[model samples]
Target chain A: MRLINQRLSPGAGAVLKTLPFVALVLAYLLGSALRLAENPNDKLLPALTTLADAIDRMAFTADPRSGAYLFWTDTLASLGRLAAGLGLATLIALLVGMAVGMLPVLRALLAPFIGFVSMVPPLALLPVLFIVMGLGETSKITLIVIGVAPIMVRDLAQKVLDLPREQIVKAETLSASTWLIGLRVVLPQVLPRLLTALRLQLGPAFLFLIAAEAISADSGLGYRIFLVRRYLSMDVIFPYVAWITLLAALADYGLDRLRRKLFPWSELEGAR
Target chain B: MTALSIENVWKEYGDQIVLENLTLEIAPRSFVALVGPSGCGKTTLLRMLLGQEQPTRGRILLDGTPLPPEPGPDRGVVYQRYSVFPHLTVLGNVMLGPELQANRLTGRSFGAARRALADQAREMIAAVGLAGAEAKYPAQLSGGMQQRLALAQALMMKPRVLLLDEPFGALDPGIRTEIHHLMKRLWNELPMTVVMVTHDLREAFTLGTRIVALDRTRSRPEELLRYGATVTKDIAIWPPRVAGRATLYDTEHPQAQDDLTAFASPAGTTRQTPSLI
Candidate 1:
């Protein structure tokens, strides 16, 4: 009990730091609940009520087989697209980021172009992308890439630029070649920052994915929500949204654990 | 033959000249210390020798050959700051040089190269008194330990010439003394040509077998001042005996040796025996 008290005392500042996030979440939940209570028969009200019912059903249900399989399948399909898009984005972004970061001329020439393109919203490009690539997986995947790659490139490049120059000079003194210095000295320092950036971008990546899907796709979570909204089938939309939130939370948590494991020095700092 | 020679080396930053017409020669297996006031171009000279910078005029030659544009395995340098890569473990930093140069492993086969390099790195680390720090990163170690790791990394390359630019300047006096002793012992065992720059007179006296002072003056030849003393057992002995030469003591006068010994002692030492040899 004494140890717990001491730990809590030190965490008082951290608790205060998180107070706003907690307050925002509480306000959101209370507002939605009050709105549902005031208009139980309204279109939006049934959707909100259906969301509550779905949460209750999923939380209390003993058997997963009782629920509709469409929700689960659509969830899996959405997750698969996300995985594919993010994986491709990560690979391409890393290559481009490393190249630009290491070479000054390349960075200067390409950075302006990338910055300008990143500002153009992916949704705004959807009509054009659909005209060119059609409403297929290619267009959707291309949208994901356009949305995620620029941020990845900028973040990773900045991290590379911020690497301690002394270390690079030391490597050069040791006669380390360009490739070896990049792989051994540069990459490890940037990995933690890259992982952190990737985790932070997860929420936006999912947002863009849903937006892309709603614009054109007839499958995945976004399409499911759109299809069900026509008949005011709030129960279906609620389950899908809830599942997406759960997936996002789970992914963020997994990345956090990975970062801690990979960087034990940061973990030590956290302990302090 | 001179193992290393610098002739009329000039370094300028815009309008300011750091080194003007500086010339020096270091013989094989000799320890030469360069000592002067701060910003006197001692580091500039070291950097030029290491091929990190090119002199505005003149050239640095290793074994009568002009130095290459880039630093090679022929010269190893240790900086005052702990320059070991913070992201790599101690072993990784030490092994990087050899792994990059000799092994040339590609792709997944780097694992085997890394292991072999790690073994040699462990030996070098132990030699430098960092026996169990192989797995630890640079940030986890103290400043002295990090400097030692840096030295180990340099030594593992086994370069013919070792260049240290005030390697112990940033360390505390006690740790500085320890590292100085360690460096002296290493030099004695390895017997490589070494050129070190330092501002600490005591450090120069302790580590240098021959010390040279640099005088940089505009429109004048750089003066090289050699201290003709040997410091041993914390006592400065007078008039470094010319190699393979004999010195006759003037026992009848005694004042000759007394005068010489008085000149060798550090400024604060009190002289009680004015006439005694």
Candidate 2:
């Protein structure tokens, strides 16, 4: 606890952060070596060359029938669903959250319903959604929305309510209309929080999106990985899982940068 | 010269009454400092004047006209915090008033009009002694600077009345004095109605043309909150001094054991609200 509390120099901090990543990679290599020594034909833990060949075929070569690169196509398909789902969630959260936060009537009416919806496991509704929406793009997108929207709405509504009450009164004195105060004062303030919320939800979103795709979709990273799972193709699965991690990390980093740029004061506030 | 009036106003939160039949009249160009103990509803009264809170049964009038149900550009306010938007730069925060007002009146705030508004905002920023720091966000500003930026933002709206709730409560003594000077100059130049709520009686004595304090007169602990608070002391200070007035208010303050229940002003009305006394 004492060591964690003490601040480290920039260089030392960087090195400490990279230490665990390096250890993980080294451990995986050693495990692969030990397994391969036991059985060279082990498909469970294929050699590095086997994984590289799979990547080249999936990434570089176009499918003979469809004339499309599987890796890129799968990435585009998956990212599209994630973006659309997140976009829909954000819109719903802003509208519903701000209303519930600002208006007592809205809060009394919808806040409980949103809370109830959030408590229900989103994955449980996937079957219902697929059945009703017919396993199309809408079903996949709706699954992501349902999985994240309720949580976002609840989080954002609480944030709005937590806003210093004086600011609301101050904005009122400035002649700001109800819509203007929400759009101008409240909207800009909550955006960084929303981004932070989005970054946190990356895990659950990926889970729901992948589950939907695995169960129904013809094309997606999850679809491809689950399709080859019958042969126990761990090589392709490993890289695909790693790709998801990389993508989520990149997204988190991107949002952090954008938040810092657009809402510098939020950083100060968070520190306080 | 009656710019604002609160006639038999009362406010309550469920079982607790905060303000009880409060009646007051503010002149068109007067600096009124409201002083009270903690939980005396001075801040509540300020909010009511700004039209942020409706009086439970009474009406508020501005220039003999009933105040609109909601707060508008007719009134401006500064709080202890949330006085400035953290997301905007000093210039942006000050400019928000003009941009919002312009957009409301003319339905457009683009091109050269915005540039002109920026120029005005820059002038207000400079007036508050924050010229070089216009581009800095609120977090980048010192406590005093942020308050000054807040003042600039509120003043830019050109409000008929300005309400401040402990605007300098968080500032150091030195900066607070500087702000006091700035406020004196602004009030000297403009004839806008200003009401400030403060816990410091000395501050109220020095800054206000008239000072009013709120407290319960009766000493029953059980009925303290039920009875709530009403205006106890209202005094007019003569011969307004712009600068070097610190010596005037620094003479003395109520000692710790003075018992505000027995407190009353030397001059002006020591009168209670209605028949409370």
Candidate 3:
């Protein structure tokens, strides 16, 4: 039924799509080899066996001082904070953004202020947050919320505003009030975009979370990285940083799956 | 009795005048197709009738009473796009109005009423030839099916006056004919009053019982803004004919013209064939 030519097959296309990631790994390997050839004692590019050993020490063994597996404890702590911060930010964005987007009076009142707030560098608020909220869990979580919520609100509000005006007018003809329109017409359309906004905010959210943790934390991946910087222990730091990257990637993949499962229509519309 | 009345209506946006000194009263169960030049205010008038935009001066009335400040079940409209809710299945979209009304009256969805409403919606969807596709979403439908779904949804409310703004503008000729026949059937069967605005002269000719041509007839540019758009030509194209009844008279009969224009203004100008836009 089919003839095979020199052109790419489906399997080949899949491999082609992942070529860049493979190339990145190869480049890192080459750089590590060259650096180690020059200086066997260099901490800048630790050997792979040394990094594997460091992972075992951090992940398999418990820290004698704290009697806890450091890797798991750090992962759990950072994940909890990330989840809480993102959840709170999403709630704030949905409520405030929908209100502002739907009502003209509210849009006029808060839209400009939101724009100004988004423009302010989120890192600049870290010091103020630290002084006000104390260098506790509250401030670190607040730092992520402050860093990501405004931009998310702006994005989701624009999505609501961008909905076709005809739909609103049509809803009104059905005798739908403002509240019913929000519930029936706007919410379903906005929900998938919320997932998209969450995916986009992941990078910045992680940035703020780590920054907050690095500055002051007894236990976190960021804290360990900074604590080991004095000894230039590239083995532990590299593994920890790679772990964070893996976690972020997993979060993104999970969101994409959820969006596909929940709102399959989004994919169809996008194909257009 | 008059179904809708527009008295000395004027609409303007900042400095540009859209409609001026427009006066007309539509009697019960009349199909008036409005055609005009591209920017000569047909849409503006439709918006006013739909209660989406109000005239800067004068008033619009329905059943000899002023319309409510907000759009409701009393007035129904179908636009060119996004007419049907995308998230709803065909049956769900058709059932929205009755379900909403039922909710308002009872504070909950009654089992019997919902079943009765579903039956009614299914019958209407069958009338529009969308019976089997009742579970399909708007995106899954073709453009023609989507327009038919919109028609079914709007008709479910059974509004006093239905406003259509080129609801079939995107349809192909075959589907357009199907819709035309479907619309004529619905209009006659329900005896509903209709106001449709279209860019196609053929459509205005085929569907409109009374064709009213809207245009700025002013020759002078300065005074043009004064009488922005008026009923330059109002013609009786077809005598009102019931589906089962035989035709009584031709539109050219002076008595038929006189009868058609009774509620419309006494325009000294006779019906003239409109130059195509």
For each candidate, what TM-score against the reference?
A: 0.78, 0.88, 0.90
Residue A25's lDDT within candidate 2 is 83
User: Taking the tens digit of each residue's C-alpha lDDT, what string does model 2 give over B50-103?
Assistant: 877788878899999998877888788888887888877888888887776667
| iRMS per model in Å | 3.7, 3.0, 3.1
Better-scoring candidate (TM-score), 1 or 3: 3
Pick by lDDT: 1 or 3, better one:
3
lDDT of 3 by residue, A171-241 (tens): 88887878877877788788889999999999999999999898998888888898899999999999999
Clashing pairs in 1: none
Q: Which ranges of candidate 1 are over 4 A from the true structure?
A: A1-38, A43-49, A55-68, A108-120, A226-242, A265-272, B14-16, B107-119, B214-277
lDDT of 1: 0.72
Please give the lDDT score at residue B32 for candidate 1.
82
Best-to-worst ranking by TM-score: 3, 2, 1
Where model 3 places Cα greater than 4 Å from the true spot, the runs are: A1-8, A270-272, B104-116, B219-227, B242-277
State each candidate's clash count: 0, 0, 0
Which candidate ranks first by TM-score, i.e. highest? 3
Question: TM-score per model for chain B alone?
Answer: 0.76, 0.84, 0.83
- Best candidate (score: DockQ): 2
Chain A TM-score for candidate 1 is 0.78
